[model samples]
Target: MAMSVIRTKRGMVKPAKETPLTTLDLSVMDRLPVLRCNARTLHVFRHGPEATRVIREALSLALVPYYPLAGRLIESKPRCLQIECSGEGVWYVEASADCTLHSVNFFDDVQSIPYDDLLPDHIPENEHVDPLVQMQVTKFGCGGFVIGLMFCHSICDGLGAAQFLNAVGELARGLNKPTIEPAWHRDFFPPQEAEAEAQPNLKLLGPPPMPDYQLQHANIDMPMDQIKQLKSSFEQVTGQTCSAFEIVAAKFWSSRTRAIDLDPNTQLKLVFFANCRNLLNPPLPKGFYGNCFFPVTITASCEFLRDATIIEVVKVIQEAKGELPLEFGKYLKGECVSGGEDPFAPPLTYTTLFISEWGRLGFNHVDYRWGPPVHVVPIQGSSIIPVGIVGSLPLPNKGIRLMTWCVKEEHKLPFLDHMHGAMDQEPL
Candidate 1:
């Protein structure tokens, strides 16, 4: 496939009038908030000869269901709406037939991608901490191409977006239609009211107004072989069944807190997310939307923090995995109302945040009539710096293939060193 550059003006790729839905149902907060977000980009690629046919067929079968994604975010009288029923919300672009399908790119020179680009950027600039979701697909002069995916933390958590992308891929590949339909059930999970409060244990922290915090980011490409080796080493060294995620997380968290002179007496919490699909009393259908998942915290006291071995930290995180239940969800909802805080508010005792992409089962499949993406990355978010670890099988070469990112300046050396050390350690 030959590669080349094509720069169309900003609005050139805009979808047709009939392309978007007109009368959207934005009664749900999730659907409404999407309106307030306006991050956009252009994906460039070498139009594949075969890609044209593939996309046409894929669109025929996939368009009906996937069409909703094309709608644009719009503000209505009372709230924001995804606005598609009358046909105005989705985004789409096509490569010329003569171009190699693999040679595609996404352009985003207009604005510095915001930390919550994937989500709505409603917060003021002074409060921003994470980068927005803004990705560009670039086709190198060589036949190679890459896909960039940016996201804001407010919209969908990592796993939630992955679920949506996976559905798109299924449609593209002519696989099973997405069994779990998306349900904007945000009405059921409103911000908590203070009178409905119970425990005041959950702490919420906001970024300092106009605070100066250096930001940094890293992308680690680990093949499966290295990942397996790292996992095995972690277990041997820790005498625990360390998952790639747990091991890496332990390394980053320990290093960051240690470097920042985290107070010994201060309670440290590792906030990891848990997908509550099967944990619900009656499992939520695959399509049920809204925030069905919640954070599961592993707490460490000053004493525990100062004296515990790396293995202990891993164990604490591992054990906390068992705490996800339907009641916990209800507890979180009630806590939100009584606390008068956003659901994404910083945890009272949260010191480190870990989001593991170790078992992201469906990312590679989002065909969309075009071929699969070469890469996918999450943009940063506010208040909390997140460490994401993506797991991939070993490549034909030597090491494991993994993808990781952190708040650049805050994490760089410590995060990298910890990952290197953890990867080098032998599992118990």
Candidate 2:
């Protein structure tokens, strides 16, 4: 079915009231050239009466506290990025689709959604002069609407972004102010002076992009009951408790590896971020909204990963988790070697896979009067740095839902089989 989204209004949504004008420094992680792109997502609500007006007004008021989002990223110096905090405002668009929510099946298969039409376009001359955020609200013919947002990765991680959106929702639902004020204490994770000399243009810094991969998207559902049972099975055998993310992600990685069918000798890497908010010395403030996660990766040969038992892989993941403090210390000191690798500048290979776990990020709770969105998921695009990454989040039924780009098209069926088999396997 062909769908078209027509824009009815577009403009900058500035803070409801004037905000302070100041220059804000970004954390070292935020300055990474690899995080220059926007994090896009779609929030589908089936009953937003005045979707655009409510969100637009709420966003304007929310901006007063989260003023950096209303600002623009500027390279105060060469390769040095900071928010100008001039209150320029966020790019906002109001749109309408010709179809109904029922038509797209409430975006269950997000891979099929027309993201370009839903998300704000980004053709910036460069990363330095772009807004920290872009947003669009599209109303369907059936009163349902999708709020498409692009939050700069340089500004907020999964947790931070969710916090901000939840606050906006609070305001939209008639709250006079955010329950918690937003903070901009970025220098807490001081920037590295060396980064200023390393890359010319942020986008051009990485290795010539991997030839465009013809990947397939697989949406795997791990019902809570089955995921819990599998986790218990691992605990009974390995005597090590693993998180839902650990259990599910490990199974997913193994399934994907087997499906890719790469050379047995090929080195493979699994990359994911560990929230480092509490990992900081003083710990981030209650309302801090910033990039506070560090990439944690484990590497092995394809043969090893593919043949390893579920418990074996879970141990590997846990071992990687245990080293986060040590590796993070090295990252802070600029020792980004393979052991303490950075996802963006890693020695990427065809066998590398990136997993981003967002199940507990609380995105499903970002209510804007119409209750929570029926579906909230990333609007994945290939132009982004970890193009074919795997994203895990919670489905409406509270099951583990994985949106994967790591599966090769030709291996799709086997990949699903392997994935479901891995999850359904006995503990031992």
Candidate 3:
């Protein structure tokens, strides 16, 4: 079902009330070289068009508390970014599509629909001054609508963005204010300070860390039963329980090594993010929105993985994951830099896979008077999908789906076969 989306209007949406005209400090995580980018998402609602006026008006009211979003991201000194709370407002766009949700099967076939069109425009000239947040609402012929959001990664992580959108939803329901007011205690983290000087050669996060080599790929929806059997088998042999992310990631590494047929001595790096919000003594505030996830990386040689059992791979990942608390502590103290900020970070290669846990991030619940979204999709326009990131998303049947990106077209089917074949491989 081919479709077209036309933009009807576009403008800035300022806060409903006057906001403070002062600069807001940033968290250490916010200043990390890895976090300075935009995160885009699409929320599809099954019901009608109260969204045009309801969301626009509610967004204004929601901005009073999340005013930093309306501000511009500026260099407070040099590499450090601070929010200039000028209350300029967020970018809003109104659009309509020529098809229905049923026509596209509610984006079950995501490739057919241009998820990019649902996102806000990228204005290079206005990059520095434009709103840290940009939103677009596209209405379908069936009265259903899609809300596309582009949030500055420096301002918050995926969970934090969901919190802000939840606030907007509350206001849309006629609530006077958000259930949990936004807090700006970024002063808790002094600028990268010592850590900043250590990595003077690190590049910013928005641009591809590696440009010349890019992987064109698709999403592979791994069935829940497959994941379950894999997880159960690992624990049965190792007698150690691991997360769905852990087991799946381990198998993914092993399978890719076989599919790509990398050199026996080729070093394989698996990078995944661990949420640091609760790792601290006193966890960050409920509304203390900022970047709080750090990448945890594990490297192994293809020869070892080729001969290793699924249990061995799982144990390797579990060991690396256990270092989060220590690494996160060093990061905040500016003693060490996260992988993304490390000038000597591991070189991304065909064997490297970045796993991001996108399952249950609450984007599916971003209500706007209508019920929760039927589907929440992540859109990667010009943004780099580093090394075919394998992300976990919820399947309606209470199952887990792995949206694996980066496997070359030629190796697609074989990569998927290796993906599922891991379950059948007997340990040598």
Candidate 4:
């Protein structure tokens, strides 16, 4: 649908009172460029003229406690990042679309959906002065509407971002205050003296070079029965219950790695982020915000991955997930305080498969006066990087959706066939 902007305004949802200088924690993740911004799209059946005013008012109130969101990014040091508590405010826009919501298909390939039309008309990466957060409330002909949220990833991860938006939704429903007040303990990963030694040049020196491979988008759904079958097969083989994520991740890793067809001995790595809130010694409070997760990498030779069965590959991933708690503890005790290894760093190679899960992020329930959203789509986090966003299907159909990015166009059919083949295979 063609969208026409009717108005634009800046909302200075300042804290109830003036906030003092608040520095973002200098953790390893705080330095990476990859974790810079995230976008989420919410669809509603109907919205009245008051919808815009109501949402803005709620956002203003929500910003009272989440003041950092309205702040601007500042380069504290060469390899560090921070936020200036300037109370600058976020950009809000209201627009109208020509087509009705019924005309749009939310389940189609994400590319078919006009992201520019659905989201705020602003360059995601502006060198002048980046907006920490921005939003667009788009109205359609059939009383339908969409709310798009764009936020800097440096300030928080998906979980933290959800907390902020959920707060706004709660306020829109006439709640006096959000159920949870966010906790910002930037110093959570304080640097340790032991990790002060020469650290690898984990800080990306410059923007990544242009890629030779053509990037494309793909969305695949795996039924619950197939997922259960895969899990059961794994348990039967090793007498160990495998999580849906473990089984699916292993399947994708094996299938995609094979489809890419790299050198036989090339070292392939599967990278994913693990929430560290519960992994911490004194678990972070339920409301603790900021980047609470760290990257966990599992590596194997190309030959091993290509030859290994889904069950075999899952074992490797299971071990990595099981040991992350211990590894994270060692990280905190050693160099986390002073920024040891860069956990959020970009993948060293195009061959490294990066998987991120948003299914459990609680995005579907961001109700704002008009019940919960019918569909919540992730418009951020997929770029030149080869990322696999693990999402969920709507109710009545229990399953998972694998939204893949940057697949080589030539390998598109092969990639899809490879992925679908894995799901269709009978249980071992």
- Best of the candidates, TM-score: 2
Model 4 poorest ten-residue lDDT run: 193-202
| TM-score for each candidate, following the candidate numbering | 0.65, 0.90, 0.88, 0.86
Tens digit of per-residue lDDT, candidate 4, span 1-428: 34353434534345555666565544555445666556556444344456677788888788778888878887866656778777666777777777676666532446667777667676435424456887888777777677877777788787888888889889999999999988876666655622432234335245566676656788889998888888877777888897888877988888888788889989888899998888765787888767777678888999998888888888899888887877676556543422344555545467778888887776766777877666567764545678787877653456998878836887778878888987787345
Descending-lDDT candidate ranking: 2, 3, 4, 1
Those runs of model 4 whose alpha carbons end farther than 4 Å from true positions after fitting are 1-28, 36-49, 123-130, 191-209, 333-343, 346-348, 380-383, 394-397
Worst 10 residues of 1 by lDDT: 7-16
Full-model lDDT for every candidate? 0.45, 0.78, 0.75, 0.72
Per-residue lDDT tens digits for candidate 3, residues 1-428, read: 57888999888899999988998867766776657778877787888576888999999999999988999988968776788999999989999999998788877665665866878766557434577898999999999998888899999888889889999999998899999878776655545454454444444343334545445555666667767777787678778787777776777778777777788988888887787778776777778777777778888998988788877888998998888788777766656445545522444556667777776566767677887887677765442344443444433545555655656666678877876666556452
- Residue-wise C-alpha lDDT for candidate 2, range 1-428, written one tens digit per residue: 47999888877889999998998878777887778887889888878978899999999999999988888788878657888889889888899999998888887876677888988765456534457788999999899899898888888888899999999999999998999888888876545634533433323334655766566777888788997887888888878688888887788788878887888998888888888888878888989888878778788789987889888888999999898888776555555434422345655555667788776786878888888888787765662233233334433476777777665567789989998887876344
For model 1, how does the per-residue alpha-carbon lDDT over 88-197 read when each residue is reduced to its tens digit?
22222222222433232222211232223222223345632222232333334434333344433334444555566556456656776665566543334334532233
Which regions of candidate 3 fall more than 4 Å away from where they truly are?
122-129, 190-214, 336-345, 381-395, 423-428
Cα displacement (Å) at residue 32, model 1: 10
- Give candidate 1's TM-score: 0.65
Preferred candidate (lDDT higher): 1 or 3: 3
Q: In terms of lDDT, which candidate is strongest?
A: 2
